[model samples]
Target: MVKLATVPVSQVAGIGAQKVKELESFGIRSVLDLLEYFPFRYEDYRLRELSEVKDGEKVTVAGTIYSEAVYQRYGKKSRTSCRVMIDSTLVTAVWFNRPYLKDKLTPGIEIQLTGKWDMKRLQVTVSESEFPGNGGPAQSGTVQPVYSVGGTLTQKWMRKSITQALKQFGEIIEEVIPEFIMKSNHFMPRKEAIRIIHTPADTAEGKQARRRLVYEELFLFQLKLQAFRTLNRSRADGLVHGYDNEELRAFIQSLPFELTEAQKKVIAEIIRDLRQPYCMNRLLQGDVGAGKTIVAAVALFAAVKSGYQGALMVPTEILAEQHSRSLQKLFEPFGVQVGLLTGSVTAARRRDTLASLQMGLIDIIIGTHALIQEDVYYRNLGLVVTDEQHRFGVNQRSILRRKGMNPDVLTMTATPIPRTLAISAFGDMDVSTIRELPKGRKPIETYWVKHDKLERVLTFIRKEVSQGRQAYVICPLIEESDKLEYQNTLDVHAQMQHAFPDLKVGLLHGRMPSGEKDETMRLFSTGETHLLVSTTVIEVGVDVPNATLMVIYDAERFGLSQLHQLRGRVGRGAHQSYCILMADPKSEVGKERMKVMTETNDGFEIARRDLELRGPGDFFGTKQSGIPDFRLADLSVDFEVLEQARDDTAELVAQEDFWTAAPYVALRHYLQREQIFQGELMD
Candidate 1:
């Protein structure tokens, strides 16, 4: 009858200093953390009828040992095999590389063995087994929690540790959600939900437990986002631009081609926001070939036309340079002086640029985060545009905004985030989508190829190079690692060089110095390097239109969104482009993902498919994407729950008495804690 309460792991029984240290490595340092450490999957080992077992089926079988356990050693490895008779049927139980298990598997012991049954080998090679007197298989057909433990921490040890901790400290864990909310949501009691999740009597109970926990997680996250929106909306002052100049239209007309309908719509939205009384916080999202850059340029031009300076911030120097060049070409004709600020600029050049910026000689400034330095000052700064906006956190953007008087902020991303996530992350901002590619652009011809087809792909790249075209060879890793299965950029570059020594091949990765990266990218962009091997650093904002061939090694290792972005780097011009996804065809997941990329060029459609295939947490690299990470709820699966929570929180906040509510108080505390945690993590 112990009450369940959240507490530090130190308060748990049997968790000494050494165990606590080990747990911390896995981001677990408290009872609350341990309790929230939900299982990735469950092992249903409650069934025990030998006759019910089918070939290649996973099940649990209970029987008495019928023969002596046989131990065989091969080199340093050993395996224990024994015959167990259940209901007069013989089944083999085998343990690999566990020589000590031979002594434990004594004959005539009444034990339960759980694993996949290989009928062809007449084996039930035990993945898990336990004795009756101990914490054996809980029950037949029951769902058993399976925690993600380190290689050194066995499944049995994890279960034992958590069970012991729960027994001693479960009573002290207080439920965060109120009883009223629970009832309204039809959620089970917190304690009961935890118990059922850890030791469910059946699959149905497990599903119910999961539903309750997932809902709670989604609800809380959505509520927090809604509260943030309410707070910001109340405090932030809106900026109003008086002038409606034709500068944006002039810039658009100066371009070689006309803007598409989708691009035009996005530009209109930006113009509307810019001219509004309130400050504009907007996100411009488009697919790879979508004309997002042009839309952003139009917004910057609008700010300049209003007689105010504008700043464009990018994540890397290469992208900053690219943006600077593109903007310079577009703005110079209109007498707009665009300046580039990056870490690699010479001291004299930087001084001149900064002086010009301070003197209002520069109309638009494009650079990396270096633009946010304390020494960098702007004259009449009225607007800020960020590329790959997620690269900069909230604090970074806040600092940039402090440079101006509530500047109209416009952010752009090539990755098309689903609307639900956009609302959750940027609820206070207006969103604009550029859904159409520019006219005369061709979709990249995509294909899924096996490793054996590398020769063919290389031959195709060589042909493209011979025809005066550029190509890109991308890898997931920078250097070879013993842990990861993906290919490294360096190794792939070397191999490709060996295969085609005559072609100008260059290598680029995050590990390279700023100067080297810039040089390599410049070489590729200028067509000096025919084949560029790189890492994901090229995943955003690097435009090389003539580069018609893209070869991604270990394409399976990349998320679908990222893979799409990388593919976007090509097919930007009139010529036909091809994207080759090189992967292992034998892997079902890899094959299916690559096929999805091959079949569709639509970013939104691919995003949905990616979410459906790999869930929310895995779809866009959420953990590393700098968005809020969830424990129990999946943003992809709990989309409906999120929508409901958002609506409910919005309604509650609209009420005058919201601040007096107990739930509001608890939510404020939770948000403060989350903010601190996020700060520490980012640091």
Candidate 2:
């Protein structure tokens, strides 16, 4: 019992060789592991007398076994039935599936069973039963923690093992929260919290235990984010560019379309960041078609006017080429050179571009990941703009920023997420949002078309294409999979080709070779392909303003935020755009998501709904490797706590010697034990 922390769990009292492996597979290798494995939920059961139990109620009743359990067969089904006597009242208990429980229901055995009261039949359906003579601590109270159990691991066995571990090693787990806070908040110590959480006397203790755990989870997360912030600022001295408005004004004036107030405001913010000594680590978030590219161009032009080169890093060659052409158009009037570098560039052309970049002939260079290649070097790089996919490709942007001497970085995301979630994901970076659509931009007409109305939807697409506009037919899958029952792009391509033989139909999916995909997209972008049958690969950076009609097949299979991104592909042109969702949602949540898609064009609203339904882990892409996986705290429900912890972290960091505090040391120790230590101090 005293050696629980450092000792291996295989050596624990009751564990055998076979059980050790099974427990280890559950990530429980040592006493420390077992102790930290908190329950996912709790079940309530209390001792109750038969007289006190009412009909249609569930209660724990103690009784004496009146008869041996017997397995009785009726026609094709068999059930195990037994009788228990509580005082003078007799009740029959039946288990439909668990015929193996006959051995445990022997006559003359004393029992306390948790079951539902069925007064009309005078029967109690035994849900869970445990014997007191089991070779482990009798872990019981009004509420019992239910762990996440898996193969060959019964809840009773796990409860017994965990109960034994708690009794043995409870003292080994230290209390990190200060004694004063624990007392004032009426929270038990970490040791006692672990004990009460696994076996709580009442719901209050369970709630208190969870509160303490949530506080620590959020506290550590804030500490880690703040630590990252400190490390980033101290990485290197930032390149400071002069504040110049004439060049930016010229570029803005040359634009044929007028800029919205949101665009103007974000551009000014970028200008201010460029003028500062510290490197700009900023996230630019604008709804689909809100003029983010224009802001990026304006910022890059500002960097160039300050007598330094800028680079724009996009995720794809198609998007990079589009940005290159757009930048050239923006900079040509002022005689600023914009060069393109992509894998598809001819070798000789790449050499020429590299030489030009080295000789400072190119004021701005735009490309895909090729921008970070060793051979390409900037003459005087001062700014790096990234067309991020909103998954926080932090490392991609970092590599591009490292191409310069701590160049100011601006990352642009078309996907609009909730403001609190944005803060959680990008706590180390400043954020500027553009929520307003540009002048003369009309909202896309969104509609939900059921399965039987597919013909009508196709007619609408045909009508739109007949008006000289293009269309995108998006399927949720690339190829048909036996596992998934949704339509795929390849089949849809064939269907479209047969249905509308007169119109040009092109196929594009992620499985296609990169060059082929690019060619297909090029054909679509240039209007040679009137209708492009594709998958969600076009959801990110593909832009075809002429494509005004979007028909999503199996629309219910995709998430709300993703559907919003798909809708963004259209509505870029002056013509009115239409997005028709082809769906047959059976579940209430799926139906609600489809309804939300039709209700609003606001990306943020869709993201908020997605957050509420799917949670933060999936909302953001997978967690970056360095980011901690919060075990107890959730960004959605714990937003207020996250804010408080963030404020507390700021105040704590401001102290002259905060790390020296005892409570701080204890907290830091816990973080170290979890392997995400608050970062080391700068040299």
lDDT of 2 by residue, 610-672 (tens): 888888877755465123467677777877777766766655655645557765776666546
Q: Using alpha carbons, what is the TM-score of model 1?
A: 0.80
| RMSD of each predicted structure | 5.2, 4.3
- Candidate 2, residue 48: how far the Cα is off, in Å: 6.6
The local distance difference test score of model 2 is 0.80
In model 2, where is the ten-residue run with the lowest total lDDT?
674-683
Compared with the true structure, what per-residue lDDT tens digits does model 1 show for residues 1-683?
33232456877776778778888998997786777777878877775686777788888888888888999999998889999987788888998887877877878888788888997878887777777876654554466688888846667667777777668765665575656677777888876787677767777888898888877776676666666555555644656665456656667899877889998898889988888756777889888878787888888888888889999999888888888888898888889899999988999999999999999999999998889999999888998898877677667777888898778889888778886677666665678998888888888899988889988998899899888899999998988899986889889999989999888899999888888998898888888998999998988879988899999998888778889989989988778999999988466767778889999999988887777777755545534543567777667767787777677667766776656776566666777776722312110
Q: What is the lDDT of residue 469 in candidate 2?
A: 97
TM agreement with the true structure for every prediction: 0.80, 0.85
Clash number by candidate, in order: 19, 0
Positional deviation of residue 605's Cα in model 1 after best superposition, in angstroms: 3.6
